[model samples]
Target chain A: MIHLLAFGMIADVLEHPEKDWPWSADTAMLRAALIKAYPELRDLPFVIAVNMDVAGGEQPIPPGATVALLPPYSGG
Target chain B: MKNIFIQGSIAASFIGESIAKHQSKTDIGAHAIFLGQVRADVIDGQPVSRIDYTAYEDMALQKVHEIREAAFDKYPLTCMHIYHSLGSVGVGEISFFVFVSSAHRAAAFDALREIVDAIKADVPIWGKEIFAEGQGSWKVNQ
Candidate 1:
């Protein structure tokens, strides 16, 4: 399983802090699955982090890798 | 990793103590501080009462570390400290504090501004503005 974490507005939309997906999925596939499950996320801008690093869409998610969906920063 | 996050609104005493700690460094001639306070902004006629901050901790810390290194490389500064709130901070409360010291005044001022701007833009921190009416909205940086 691949662990997924959500933060900020993305968390509010997901209504949950974390979830798990199939480890075979790459970043692109995972994003597609997320957009399918949470359609609102499609229009919102966010980035995917794989193992605590910002990842491109093509990055593969290895088994047990920690992934996160991060929305635009609002910090001062 | 040096923890830069405070759990709630930063206390005035903490800021004072931080300043006091630097008294032993006599070579530091000037210090510049920037404090960010929560404002009660009215949105759709509802006043915001507080802000709840959250972050992707690992990534945020890494980004902060990079920012610190870049600052030190770009500016001639003796030392710098950055503190940001991680939880709820009420209106009129301090949320962010940036302290920079240098041998000269010009470097302090310039480095302080650049560092703060970099943090605001680069860090993976988020703020949710809670309204007086119990509703809240995710804050968007403008």
Candidate 2:
């Protein structure tokens, strides 16, 4: 299982901030699967981070790695 | 990884104490501070009463430290401190604080702005604006 961390509106949609889900081959697949599971996420703009580093492209998701779904940062 | 999250709105006395502690650093000739207050924004006819902030703690610490290091490298700063609210902050309350000190005023001012801008853009934190009637929406940086 891979770890997933969702924040902000995405977390509200997911109903929980953290989860362990079946692993996907790459970030593209992960994004697709998450949107499928939570259709509400399709309309939002966000980025994926793998193990603390923002994913630049469709990269492989190492087993047991933590992935974060980050929305537009509103921090000050 | 230093935790910069404060439990709620930062108190004015806390800010004053922070300044007082720096008095012993005689070499520092200038200090620049930026405080972010929760604005009473009216969105779609509803007035926002407060803001509730949250963060991915592990990532925030890492990101904030990197920001601090970058500021130090680019500016001759004597020291820097950052604190942000983690829970509900009422309108007009201070939710963010950035303090930078240097031997001269220029470095302190420049670094302070850069640091604040970077934190707003790069940190994995979020704020949910709670309307006076109790509805809330996630806020996005402009």
Candidate 3:
């Protein structure tokens, strides 16, 4: 399991195995893997974007990859 | 070459040394410096005391590189440096610093302004304003 670094909110990997990621999982099987591995993030109000693209459908985060969990940016 | 971002607090010595390093170039006759300081502002009947900053580091570094390139191309600048805080900054603490050196006053002045504007608009950073009374809110540049 890769250490997911999120700035604001915590993501639970124990609750949802078959469900797609909050944003998008790259592969159908990978989506299943995430939910199975981290089911705790299944119901959170969060969005996942890769390279700033919000992945929404059945895409899984590429295996062995790291991504930023950006909710929104507001700074002066 | 001095990297754009540093982990420690920005001291007056850092600013002075950065300027002194470029002094060897006699062609550079002028240097402009800008520092952005945090202020405790009242918001919704609460007083803000500090800020916590975070960024999309990879994206921010890329944007800084692009700004440096564009600044040199658009103006006759000998060199420049930009620094910003990535973590918590209290009231009266400095958060942003931009320094520009050029052959003349006009170019340095213009380039300094451009760099600051670009940093505010292009950088993927976020700030949480901490209030003196123990409350906070997300802040956006106006």
Task: Give me the candidate number with maximum TM-score.
Answer: 2
Q: TM-score, chain A, per candidate?
A: 0.87, 0.94, 0.40
**Regions more than 4 Å wrong, model 1:** A55-58
Query: What is the descending TM-score order?
Result: 2, 1, 3
lDDT of 3 by residue, A33-74 (tens): 445755754553334444444455544565445544444555
Model 1 per-residue lDDT tens digits across residues A10-54: 998899889886665678888898898899999998888889877
Question: Could you give candidate 1's fraction of true interface contacts?
Answer: 0.93
lDDT to native, each model: 0.91, 0.93, 0.68
Candidate 3 local lDDT, residue A73: 52
Tens-place lDDT digits, model 2, residues A12-76: 88998999988998899998999999999999988888898885677889999999999998987
Deviation from native of the Cα of residue A62 in model 1, angstroms: 2.6
Off by over 4 Å in 2: none
Candidate 1: DockQ? 0.87
Query: Candidate 3: lDDT of B4?
Result: 58
Estimate TM-scores for all models: 0.95, 0.98, 0.71
Better of 2 and 3 by lDDT: 2
| Tens digits of per-residue lDDT for model 3, B3-67 | 55655356778888888798688998999999988888789989888887777677677778888
* DockQ scores of all models, one per candidate: 0.87, 0.92, 0.30
